[model samples]
Each structure stands twice: as C-alpha cells, then as structure tokens.
Target: MDFLHSGLAAIQRHLAFVAVDPIDWKFYVQAFSWTVTLFESYLLLRQYPLYSKTSPPESLARHIGQEDFEKSQKYGKDKAQFALFSKLFSQCIDSAMLQYGFYAWCWKAAGSILGKFGYGGDYEILQSIVFSFTMYLLSSLPTLPLSVYSTFVLEERHGFNKVTPGLFISDLLKGWLIAFVLGAPFLAAFLYIFQWAGDRFVPWLMGFMISFQFIMVILYPTVIQPLFNKLTPLSDGELRSRVEGLAGKLHFPLKHLYEIDGSKRSSHSNAYFFGLPWSKHIVIFDTLMQQSKPEEVEAVLAHELGHWYYLHPTKMMAISQIHIFSILALFPAFLHAPPLLRSFDFPKAVAARPPTIVAFLLFQMILTPMEAFISIGMNAVSRHFEWEADRFACELQDRLKEESMTDMGDRLGRALITLHVKNLSTVWVDWLYSAYHHSHPTLTERLKALESFQAKRAKKE
Candidate 1:
C-alpha cells in the first residue's frame, strides 16, 4: 500500500501543474475530439468507394450469389453514407454543446431539479446522478432520429428489421428505466468510494469496477436479457447434442443452452457463452440456427469454446483493469483543478470546489486522443484472439482425438460465410478503417487463415 501511494503520489506531482495552471482545457478537448472524428470520417471516405465495386472478390464469388452480392453492396453503401452523415451531425452537436457550456448548464439544471424535490447541492452524489442522466437523456435525443431511420428505414429497406414502431418505443422506454435503475446506485457507490478513500481511491475503485463487471455478467443473462428477448432452452436435438458433447469433451462447465429470439428485433445472428469460471451458459440466436447446418453451428461453438480454453475474456478484462487504473491514477491532479472546470464555463462557486463527477467527466474529455490510440491497440489484440479461436476450431479433431471432427474447419468456414451473406456484411474493407473499427478479421482473412490451419494440421497428422 505504501509503495502504491508513493508511486501514485509521484504521478500526481508530475501532473501538479494541472491544479494551478490556467490552461484552456476545453479548447484542447475540442481540438482532440475533432481530430479523432475527422480522422474517422476520412477512414469512412477511404472505405466508401469499396461499396461501388460491381463484383465480389474472386475467393468469395463462388460463395455469394449475384443477387446477394449486389444486395450486400447496396446495403454497405447505404450504411456508409448514413455513418458519414451521422458522424458529422453528432460531432456538430457535441461541438456546439462544448462551445456553449452545455455541461456546466446541465450541472446547474440538475441541482435545480433536485431542489424542487427538497434536495440541495449538499447532496453532491444525488446531483451527480441527476446530472448524468440529464446529460444522457438530452445528449441521446439528437441521435434518436438517426437510430429510428437506421432501424425503420435502412434496415427495413434491407429486409432485416423485425421491430414494429410499438416495439421500438417500448424498447426505448425500457432502456431508460434500466439505465436509471442500474446507473444510479452504481454512480452513488462510485462517488462514495472516492469520498471515503480520498487520494487512495485507485486500488479500491479498481476492485469495485471489477466486482461490478462480475455482477453484470450474472445479471445480464438471467435478468436483463430476458426483459428484451426470450431465451428458451435449445430444444433437444442434434444441435443441442453436438454442442453439449463438445462442451463435455472440453470439460466446460456447461450450465444451460438457450436459443434467443434475436429475430424478434433484427435478423442479425450470433452465439456466445458467459458466466463464472465454474459454470457458464451458451445462448444461440434462433436466426443462426435457421441459417446454418447443425455441424456448422457446432463448429462455431467449437470456436467460441476455444475462446474459453485460451482465456481471451479474462485477458481482455485484465487489460481493461490496467486502462481503468491508468485513468484513476492520473486523476487527482484534475480532481481539484478549479481552472479545469472554469474553462468549461462553470460558475466560480462551482469551480472552486470541483465535484468528483464533473472532474471525472472533464478528465475523460481530455483523454480523447489517448483513448483513440488505445482502442486501435485493443482491436488489434482482439483480432489476434479471433485468429487463434479460428485455428482452435480448425484443429479440434486433434484436440479431442475425434475422427468425426476432422472437417470442423470447413464447417466453420461455411458457417461464417452463411452468416456474412445473411447479414449482408461488407466483403471488401479498407485496411486502415478496419484497424480503427473492426474487432474481428474480415471474412476473407478468416477464411484464408482457416485454410492454412487445416493444411498445417494435415501435415501434423
């Protein structure tokens, strides 16, 4: 503890200028945020032209029918245009808000709302909660039109939207309700820890954040997900048998197998597993089952289980802890910086004693450039994990010593191709755009890698 305190103290001293310096933090934030936004827009520009191609690549031409390829190209072009427009639109709103003191106004508005209910500024946590939701609800309003257009217009045009207007509104309201229910207590606990631990909040806060993640892992499947979609146990059949057999062979603590009604809202398909280390549940989208063969689905699960075998999720969580700690460790210098808040147009009284929430929020804005770089690195690591999982699926026969699984790689490849075609996923991608945004390798990349894995395994055999 002493060593940690000393280490953190040294960091705080290095950043001590933040506390007393009269820096134009808001200007820096605007510059950094705009730089990220414009660079992303440029990447989209680089990628937009790919959608104009008249044919699929030679490798995928056999897999995708002419009609499907054209449809996917059209979908990709439409989405790219929407993305380019929405990115600029959202950035305009954000830039205007910052230029005109929206955040500072929100803090005061939250205090006023609380005052009406007999609460006062003395309740900083309550004010912070109110301020957070205020920002969330208001800031989200500007993008609601885009969301509706994407769901109803774009997706509906492409024959993927399964949502009615009524369902959409209901989902929106439920989302708000859930956010408040979960976020309020979480924010309160977060602020309380800072107040209690003072300068020593890093380790304590890291523990809390990790604990919250574990709780969410348990809650999301059992409670929160059911509210959005149904998750019935996969009916006893070949798919279930294969999945269970695979799990048992791997000695995975397979607790439950469910098929989700993902088609209830969208035609997108996926499957994943989650739970504690001792027990886990696998949920497959009904659309996935409808689209692929039993063997192909089994191969997909083999790849998913590979993620478990290699501890990808745990490694990602560890990286996230380091990210969070880095943020918290460098926070104290900003925590009391009156000028940081003042530059954002906060009133003198409010700026004099920076609220933890305000300080944290502003600090995050200051980290726009750093966060963008971190996102690229994280995506690279994620893509590497995906490659490993693909190889694992390919080599499953060797791992389990099962002759029946020798062709798992081909099955997985077919499954992935089917998924991409059904979802109208873009085939041609810009390398720079993909590095910045995509968490998985492109279909061609994965397919090529899968073939290599198969060849290597054949040589070993």
Candidate 2:
C-alpha cells in the first residue's frame, strides 16, 4: 500500500506541469473523440458489407436452415444500418456539446439548482451530485429518441421486441427513479472521499468502488432486477433436475435456480449465474427454455458454470480495479489543474478551484482515445475467457466422470446455433470489426473449437 502511494505521488509530481501548462485540452479531446467515432464508423462500414452475404458460414451451414439464415442476414443488415447512423448521430450531438461547452453550462446549472435548495458552493459534494444528474439527464435526452426507435421500430420489425408502449414508458421512469435512488448517495460518498482523504484518495476510492460492486452483485438480483423482470423459481421437472444435478456434481454452491421473464422485453435467450463465492444463484431466461431442449439448456448452464469454475468474473473484476486505479492515480494533477477546466470554457473563478467532479469528467473526456484502445484489450481478454469456458464445458465429462455428459460439447454447439438463429445474431463477421467489437468468440468459431475439443478428448480416450 505504501509503495502504491509512492508510485502515485511520483506520477503526480511528473505530471505536476499539467497544473500550469496552457494546453488546449479541449481541442485534443475533440480531435481524439471524433477520430475514435469515425474509426468506429469505419469498422461498421467494414462489417456492413458482410451482412449482404447470402448464407451462414460453412461451419454453421448445416445447423441454420436457409430461411432462418436469410432472416439473420436481413436482421444483421438492418441493425448495422441503424448502428452506423446512430453512431454518427450521437457523435454529432456530443461534438456539438463539446464545441459549445455544454459541460461548463451544466456545472453552472447544477450550482443554480443547488442554490435554490439553500446550499452554497461550500457543499461541493451535494453540488457534485446535482451536477452529475443534470449532465446525465440533459446529455441522455438527445439520444432517448434513438433508444425509442431501436426498441419500437427496429426490434419490432425484427420480430423480437416484446415491449409495449406503456411498459416502455413505465420501464423508463423506473430506470430514472432507480438511478436517482442509488446514484445520489453513491456520488456523495465518492466526492466525500476526495475531501476526507485529500491526496491519498486512490486506494480508498478503489476500496469503495470494489465494495460497491460487491453490493450491486447482491442487490441487482434480489432487488433491482426484480423491479424490471419477474424471476420465478424454475419449475420442478427434467430441466430443474438436470441443472441441480449438474450443480451438485460440480459443487457450484447452487443457492436458488430461477427462470427470468426475459421475453417480456425481447426474445433474446441466455442464462447466467451470480453471487458471492459462497452462495450463487443461476437464472435462465424463459425464452431459452422455450427455444431449446432441457438437455441443451443444461449444456448452456454447463458453459456458464465453466465461467464460474475458472473464476472469470473475479479476474475481470480485478482487471477493472486496476483500470480504475490507473485512472485515479493520474487524476490528482488534473484535479488541481485550472487550465483543464478553463480549456472547456469554465469561468475563471470556477476553474481556479476546480470541483472534483468537473475535473474528473474532463479528465475522462481527454482519455477518450486511451479508453477506445483499452476496450479492444478488454474485449480480447473476455474473448479468451469465453474460449476457456467453452473448453471447460467440453471436458466436463472427464472432470465429473459422468457418462451421460459425454456429448456436452455437441449439446452446447446446438444451443449456440439455436441461440444465434433465434436472436438473428450476425454471423460472417469481418475479422477486424470483430476484434474491436466482439467479447465472445463467434458462433462458428465456438462450434469449430468445440468440435476440436471433442476430437481431442476422443483421442485421449
């Protein structure tokens, strides 16, 4: 811990010049952000051509019928077109916001609102909370129509949208309410740490963030998720029995098994498990049950369990903590830099003693290019984890010495194909586009890997 602080202090000293340098941070931010946006748009253009392909990849050809394959292609094309336009549209809105100093205006507006409530600038934490929500609400407003069109028109045409107009409105309101209910206290505590800890905020902030994630892991399933979707204990029968038996064999600490009403929003089919190390719950989407057989669903659970067994989630969390630490460690210099705030058109008085939230927000904007690259790295790591999980599922028969589980790989492959067909997920992905965007191996890639895994096991036998 002492060494960590020493390192952070060293970094702060090295970047101390940032406090006095008159860099045009705003121009750099704008240039880099637009560059990323355009590059992403280019990736979409690369991927857009693949959607015109007439059929699924040759490996997937046997699994997907011609009509279903055509549907997937059409769906992919439609989604890609929407994505291209939406990406450009959003960038334009954000670019305009930056060009006109919307962030500076937002901070002032937050102060105005805070003053109306009898709070002064001395209440920085309270003011920060107001500033956050004000920015979130106002910035999000411009993109809300895009979200609406995606859900109502685009998804509806794809025959996947299960959201009614009234339900959509209700969900939106509930989401905003939940955001306020949770976000205010979290933001207050976050800013308070900066005050309480002063320059030694990095380690403490990391601890708080990690604790919050743990809390969310508990609250999301039990409280927040239940608000959005129904989760009934999976009905007793072959599926439940199979899942329980698999869990027992793997010693997965199975606590509660649930079937979530995922079809209430969309026809997407999936399953996942989450909880602390000791107690875990598995939730399967009802749509998955409706689409695939009991055994196939069991196979899907097996693949998910593979993730748990390999500690993928924990590893991912650790990686995120490091990412956060990197961001926080470099923040103190920027936090004290008046020029950074001024570059974005903040008032000289406000910029001189910059608010923590304002500085952090600008710092993040300056990190746009870096974050874009970090996402590519994270995606690579996630895709590797997915491969390992698939392999783990393939070899489960050997791990448990269960004869009945011999065809787990085949079952998983079938489930993957069914899911892709049902969801109309893009198949024939451009390699470069996929490297940037995909967090999991494509369906054909996974199926081919599974085939090799089965073959390898057979050879060992």
Per-residue alpha-carbon lDDT of candidate 2 for residues 1-461, written as tens digits (9 for 90 to 100) = 89988998999999998999999998999899989999999999989889888867887788899999889889988998999899989999998999998999998998899899899889888888888998999999899999999999999998999999999999989999989999999999999999999999998999999999999999999899989999999999999999999999999999999999999999988999999999999999999999999999999999999999999999999998889989998999999999999999999999999999999999999999999999999999999999999999999999999999999999999999999999998888998899999999898789989999999999998
Question: Which pairs in model 2 have colliding backbones?
Answer: none
Per-residue error at 285 for model 2, in Å? 0.5
Q: Write the per-residue lDDT of candidate 1 for residues 289-382, one digit (tens) a residue.
A: 9999999999999999999999999999999889999999999999989999999999999999999999999999999999999999999999
Q: Model 2 reaches what TM-score against the true structure?
A: 0.99
Off by over 4 Å in 1: none
Candidate-wise lDDT, in order: 0.96, 0.93
Candidate 2 regions exceeding 4 Å error are: none
Clash numbers, per candidate:
0, 0
